[model samples]
Each structure stands twice: as structure tokens, then as C-alpha cells.
Target: MPQAQKGICAEPNLHALYLMFNVHEDHDEEVRRILAQILNIFDHYDDEHYEAMVSGVIAIGSNYWMELYPGFLPAELAPFPDMHCEDRHAPVVPCDLFIQMRADRADICHAMGTAVYDALKPHVELVEQIKGFRFLDGRDLTGFVDGTENPKGMHKLDVAIIGDEDPEFAGGSYIHIQRYRHNLSKWNQLDVPHQEEIFGRTKTDDIEFASEMKKPFAHTKRTNLKDANGNSIEILRQSMPYGDMKEQGLFFVSCAKSPQPFTKMLESMIFGDAHGNYDKLMDYTTAETGAAFFAPSVDFLKFQGMS
Candidate 1:
């Protein structure tokens, strides 16, 4: 098996930096050089305390993948599609490249982010950057624990890393990212029971509702998708809460063997079930940015020469 990125299955970090960039129209060659340089730095970084992962967009208009991998691309790779419902919209804003850095300390994450920005200075323009931190016991700003249903142990590897299904891209993972801004004032106005009904779980105890008791439009129910055979589809969530007094919400990060699970979940959230009710969580939060990228194996990056 090819070596996967260290951060995919690593323990959750206390601090993270999410960076997205678009290459200059005529500077594709220069951007490639910068990728190799940044990868070299990641190669020597201490994974015990910090982790870095990189990815490039694979759509037709983006030359990053064509110039590097040529004919090989993740089977499900595509530009993120916009989502709309009766009252809300999730817009698609694709970027050419993405870099994520995580560490236990804020200073370490900052230093790594600065190094990456310096390397790509001349070739790329920043699209979005977010600093995320783990909230109390990994809860979101809404006062409920996040990622309670994520796969654990070896199951995480099974759910996240590409295997025999796509042998050529084995060990790679498809990633989806979005930034959500919360309406804390509106959310805070609701009682605890009302909030729990929206999430389908008890806020204080983190206990999920029984299947029969779950509402059709509850967040947990809407997002939990199953395959045709009735087996549950899973995705590794590395999301974290971000904000200040002015802005606060989640920087959603999801990794999977393929993009199907993430795409399906998003559709369900934005459009709702056959009954036509969407996720109530959206009523309290607004999606500001959405994009998709493919994070390749470490071995692939080391050998694919951009110079």
C-alpha cells in the first residue's frame, strides 16, 4: 500500500490552519515548483506534534493535475456543485490548491502556515484562510459535541483511505471543505430541548435519539446515508469550530475514500428527504464557502517531479 498523509487518521489537534489558493494564470509552472518545495518541508516536519496535508483541484480548467499527474485522477474528482433549497443556498467556489496544517500549539501552526505562504508567494493568490481551534471537549459553538458518529480505530482507515476500489490512487483520500457562520443570537433564543430536537441528541449528555424517535429533518438523520445494500456510509470528519465575537461557526472538513458520501450528505442537508424538509441546523448557520480537492499519497508527491 502507498503511504498516506499522516494527518488523515491522526488524533484531533487543538489548533489548525486551512489555506486555499488559486494559481496565477501564467504561473502554473512556478506553482508546481512551489508545491515541491513545500512538500520537502513537510517531509522533515515532526509529525509527533504537527501535521501537514496538500491537495490540488482536478477539474478540466485547473491545470495543476494535468501538468503533474497527466492521465491519472481520482475517479470521483470534480468541481463542487452549488446546492439550493426553498430558503437557502450553498454556493460552489473552487480553488486550485489546498493546504492544511494542524498542531497542539497555536504558535506551531502559525509558523508552518507562514512558511507555506512564503514559498507560494509569487505564484498563487489566496482564496480563503481560516484558523480553527478545538472547543471544549470537541463541541461546536452550539454547545453540542461534534463528530460523535465518526469511525474509530482501523475503521477510520477503512472509511477514509482509497483501497482496491481505485488501485491506481490507493492511499489517497477525497476531501470536502466549507466555512459556516453561525447566528448565535438566533440560536441562543431557543430552549435547550428545542435545540436538541434540531440536532437529534441531548446537548448535556450527548446521547443520540433512537431511530424511531429521530425527526426526519434532524441534522443527524439527514446526514446519515446508507449504501444500496443498507450498510452505512462513513466519512472521517476533521472539522473544528472557529470564530471571534463578530463571527463564529464551524470550518467543516471531511475525508473519505470517495466523494459520494460527502456529496450525498450535503445534498440531503440542502434539499432534504423526499418529504421536502431540510436540516434545521441550516436555519442557525449559513454556508459561506464550499470546495473539493484530492489529497494524494505522500509517496506520490515525493516522486512526481514538477521541476
Candidate 2:
């Protein structure tokens, strides 16, 4: 039997929960209080993490906030999707909150419901009422399966950088989040080979297409970074498969040395360049949300600038 070819890369535990909210400038203090109260409740009741294992940092200068999961959650509360066939596990069965100041109440409700899968856990009962929302599932739009192949072990080191990415950020990395919607009905219509072509790899992430047949024009090819000596630059991809059947998709998050790589990747995705033909997967998905945020090191939270 042929020895199995070693896979080149992997993914780490990637659990994500985000929201954009509305808060008047005058109410910043109150909003911070509400957020802090919620965080406290979760920190106390949440069996998975404590302050040490997790990093709860305030972003947007009390206007925005986020919490990082130090590890995975219990089996009862894990993120699941239909497409994954691997005997796998869930990562960071944690939650987060965001404020939507630009939109009205209805829009905020829809965004949370659609982006966070509130129905699956019943926001009122689990969060507001129970003080926390039990973890649930985040699936991409196509509904076949998602997040089955993630980087683990040294791969985490490869993709998630340390102090090198940002001087002030010694332990943390830059985080980027994008919400994408999938046209599953449309995607389902395409043949499997075509799907594979769009992804630039096998469904299992096991193989790339034959070099000649490979679509050299793709974000994968373009942003597949190389060092000064021409080695692949590594970045951690902790993106989670998110969305429901109707308004579902991915909560794409990546941490890297600099935003340039990701920006260049997106540019290639939007306007196909030489090697990046753009992600053919776009045929079935739409980019609906985009934002860039800095995830500073724990020590750098209080510091401003150069971080």
C-alpha cells in the first residue's frame, strides 16, 4: 500500500460569536456596565474558562467588546454543522456580543438572529434570562458540512503568530472577521468537481488539483505568502462555519502578522489578479459583513498606538 502523503497544514479550534450594536455616545458608560455584568455572569457560570484561560478585552474603547476562548467547551455544548464527515470535535464553545448603533432595533434583532443563530439557543431564555447562551451550531449556507478540517498543534503556531506580527502585540494576533452568505441551492446545482475547483483543494483538504489543471487564479494562490527566502508565510485561520439554512454562511476570522496579506487576499477575491483567479466559491456565497479589528496582547490592552 502507498504510504499516506503527509498533509501540509491544519486548523486550530475555531469558535466565534460576534454582534454589532447600537449605543448612544452618552450611554457608553451604561453599555459598558451591561457588558461587564454579562461577562461577569458568564465568567462565573461558564464551566470552560476563567480569566486565566481566556482573554476578555474591551474593544472600540468601551464602544466594542470581545472575549477569547482559551480552550474548547463541553461535549453538550459544541458547534456542529451538517457538512462535516470527520470524527471531529468543536473548538471554543464560547459566545460574544456586539452592538449595532447604525441600525434600528429590528435590524439588530435580525442581525443577531441571523449571524448568531439565536433561535437555536433562545437568546431571551439562555442569555438574558439564564445569564448565558448555551453553545450551539454554526454552519455555512451550503449545508453539506463545514469546519471539518482545522489546523491543530504546530499548525496553530504556523498560522497564529506571536510578537512578530505586531510589536506591541506579543501574545495576541490581528483578527479579521467577515460574514458570508451561501447560495446553497445554487451551490448544490454545481457538480462536486466544480466545487473542488472553487475551493482549490479536495473536499477533505487532502489534495490540490493537478498543477496544470489548477486554477492559478485564486486567493489561495495569491495570498499563499512566502518569506524573504520564499517560504510560505503562516497565519492562523480560526474561521467557523456559521449560518442557518435560509440566511446562513461563514464567520471568517483570520489572525496574521499584518492585515496586508488578508487585504491582498480579499482584493484578489474581489478582483482576480495573476495567480488569484478569485475564490470561485463566490459563485455560491455573498460577502455581507466586513470589519477589521486589532486583537492586542493581554498586556497591551491598556496601551494605545503602535499596537
On lDDT, the candidate that comes out on top is 1
What digit string (tens of lDDT, one per residue) describes model 1 on residues 1-307? 9988777777788888888888777876666556666766555455434343322211112225664467777777776767888777887777888888777778777877898899888877888889999999989999999999999999999999999998888888888888999999999999999999999999999999997898898999998889899999889998999999899999998888988898899999989988887899999999998888788876666566443
Candidate 2 TM-score, true structure as reference: 0.57
Where model 2 places Cα greater than 4 Å from the true spot, the runs are: 1-16, 26-42, 45-151, 154-167, 210-212, 302-307
Query: Deviation in angstroms for 131 in model 2?
Result: 17
lDDT of each: 0.80, 0.40
TM-score of 1: 0.92
Steric clash pairs (candidate 1)? none
> On residues 61-124, what C-alpha lDDT tens digit does candidate 2 reach at each position?
1113322222311111112111111221112222233321111122332333343333222322
Q: Supply the global lDDT for candidate 1.
A: 0.80
